[model samples]
Target: MDTQIGCAIKASNELVKNLHRDGFDRGCIATFNDYMTTFTKNKASLHRSLNGINNAKNGTRLYDSIVDVIQIFRNRGEVSRPWILVVVTDGDDNISSRSLHKCAQETSSLFTTKESNNFLFLVGVGDGVNSEKMNEMASAGNFIYIHAKDFFLLELIFLKIANKITTSLSLSLGNLTVGDHSASWAEVQRHRNLSKVAIDYALLIDVSASMNSRVISSNSVTNLNSVITHATRAIGQSFDSRIINTTNVALLASWIDKKRGNPYNFSDLPFEFKLIHRASRDGFGNDKFHNNCDNKGPTIVVIKVKYSGEIIGGYNPLEWRCVKINEWSTLLPNNHDFYIDQQRRTSKSFIFSLTNQTISRVTLNNDAIIWSRNKGPCFGLQDLCITNNFGKSEQRSYENRIINKKNFEIEEYEVFQVIDKRPRFSIFYFIFMIFMGIFKIIKFIFMRLFLGIYWTCYIVYWIIYWITYWTVITLICVAGIGLIVSILALPIILYLYLEAEIAWVILSALFIYAPILGLIGEYLVI
Candidate 1:
């Protein structure tokens, strides 16, 4: 056997040992190359079968082997316990007669049965393996796919699978210290009496007298409510019109829990706009701003105008940094656009007034944004510059002015880091893209083939035409030379009969005429 197959066998033995140790009662072993065979469920017999795998075959019939195992399970009748089928291979399927799609359909049908508790895992090892096809098959088959760089990692992969199986079967209490657990609400409802059930509860209570006192006055609560309402409206207006519906507004409003007195926690937001910095909670200092917002890419700054209750903010696609003057000057020589006080260019940066429903994008690409240690968030040349808790707005480098006020006091401002929360690839989308890619590849191959044939035929035609022309010219020259020789020989015979020296003259003339006639025929052909 080859070294790779040997290592794989060793790993398989390790997997069997670990699964047996982990309280697994019964399991079967199967091996595949040109043909596949499933050994008896007896642990000792399976071990012997694994040890006896000395002949490493040349072909991998992976799909056919999986189907055979599935057929065996089908023939075994109904299974009372959960069954797992792990298929490990180090190479692509080269000898499988069953198509991948057909095999996938068969595997997926196993889960459609109400009594079926089957789990399939595809483990691919080695660099030469086609991981994409394996993953696709796994997805279509509704199974998990794990990739290992080499056979050495197979033991760990199998151990993980075993652990997953154990965990799925066992009761989970989640993190005990965090006091959070996962339980089906339907299951909880099925219980007869909640009070009769013994449960452990940990309650944190404040013993101080301040806990009994009403710290926030009724007027302050009213103002807080108004601010929250304005902020919620601003958030709703900030997004696209399609997403500004009532459901989204409710989701955005839920970011702040009024009952808990927590203003910023966007864990429930459908999109990823995490509130990273809140001026009221984190403090309204430039140092606090930089500490929370620096190097946190693509932040959205929302400000509530003090008395007017107008909401205005800017979006900075670049990271916010507090560069010292000396440090800034050093970078200036290397990069002309790298400035801490003057400007930073980004076409994506924009200032907006959510209250006015106006979005003003950057007009001057060279001077789109500015960063300063003393400023909170600045855009353009004082288009919207927030210094400490106060800010100013003007129509400088941006397309339109966001606010009419030259200076405004900030009531509340929040900085949120934009996060990419796009969902995972849909199986249908992945399959569609794969088919499109294949079609394009096939089209390109055919185009290249057609061009190659056309050029080949064109070159062959010129070659054959030249060869025919040269053959015709040679035939004409040879016929002319023979005719001159025959005529000169007759005259020489006659001259010999007369015993005259004119025969030598006629022979010399024949040589000269033959050369002249050949040259004339060559010129006429050209």
Candidate 2:
């Protein structure tokens, strides 16, 4: 045993005695059973019973020491710190009148439940110690039976207990709200090429008269072609200016035909003769905006596709002038409308910002301009691949399709605010995930169970419920068809195959399940 621990116990006892309180005070110890035996200090004491039972005061000594400490907070409301009982025993309390179980149970219950008792620590030393009984008296992780012999090791343990009782922890909450003065937003790009394929991008800027004024001066672009040229090169394949001409970039302008004064002719359409913010016949390209600040919010002006013709999901085309600012739309009157016709697409009602806000903005519903090349023949919907700076353009040689060899870091968007948040999908997302996992496991077990004498009753029960209700009826029918086919097909399939006979038979038995199994019709397979 550590010398420091024994000293701490003695010192703690002294400090506890001087404190004044009743209910607020806590600390107690009870030694019991056929294990630890405390010795008396006096040699001249005579036994009242003469058989040593009356004279043995081991239990009394422990009880007195515990009560003296517990009495400090016994009558008061509460104490500032926890009350701990440091129990050091040679072995089990064999000489005590009470059983070890009773001692462990009642003592622990009283001190903790008592207003003064908030914390506890128990230590058992050496061989023959009743560790299980000690565990019952104290919390599992809190109770420890030291492997050393005697009271020598108390210093290290009690000091740790003292440290734990004094520390405090808390959770604090506060964040930005909508309509705050500062409206910031953010965008992300792959730090490295996610794929070695050619990278393509498009920047759609608002060439409206409002955006023509220079940042330093009121001078607007006199030449529309010059603004297009500057923007295309500014946002091309790489940020490095030296290699700008070497890269392949295509560009398109929004309201190009509208500005050209002949909106009806497709020949004089919004698309450009050269690739400036434009896509090829395949529809993959880039858009770089030299003119900054679109006071008009999120809108589609340009688009980008990659490889030969794959337009992967990236940013929303309906952003304000297709610019990446923390807060552009909510602070300004210029947000665009949704695309004309698309499925599974959300209205551009809310913009994602780097910060939160409180006030809503005003805008027109029909003002949204959609720049789509989907109508033209050269614009193959799926075939046109305008590349982004996707790095290596040759990645099809791998045998393992799931492996991504490059270390590509994507830009992470720091959530700005809670605008138009969907609570319905949020609440059930976790539940849906958990249900799918359990369903998969149950299906696996059922498949294995069906291979035995359990096939007929299973098939018969499913037959009844599958036709019972509308919601579940179709599911039952599907499962029934698949199940019946499996049972019938397995036998015939095995008889034809030589090497694969048993294997196909086993494989075919597990194939009779619907996407939603027992839940669909409330199955009964005993």
Per-candidate clashes come to: 0, 76
Q: How high is each candidate's TM-score?
A: 0.34, 0.23
Each prediction's whole-model lDDT (CA): 0.59, 0.28
How many clashing residue pairs are found in candidate 1? 0
- Residue ranges of candidate 1 with Cα displaced over 4 Å: 21-24, 34-41, 114-116, 172-526
lDDT of 1 by residue, 1-526 (tens): 2356565666667555544422224555566742333423355755676676665545677788777777766665245655567777766777788988677766655542323244566776656568767755754465556665545445545555544443334354232111112222222222212212211100011111111222222335454444333323322222211111222222233322112332222334434666788887788888899899998988878776676656568888787887655553654465334325657888878777644445788899888878787788999898999888999988889999888889989877788787655576899889999999999999999999999999999999999999988977887777777767767677766655478577666776666567667666776786
- Look at candidate 1 and tell me the lDDT of residue 236: 20
Q: Positional deviation of 79 in candidate 2, in angstroms?
A: 7.1
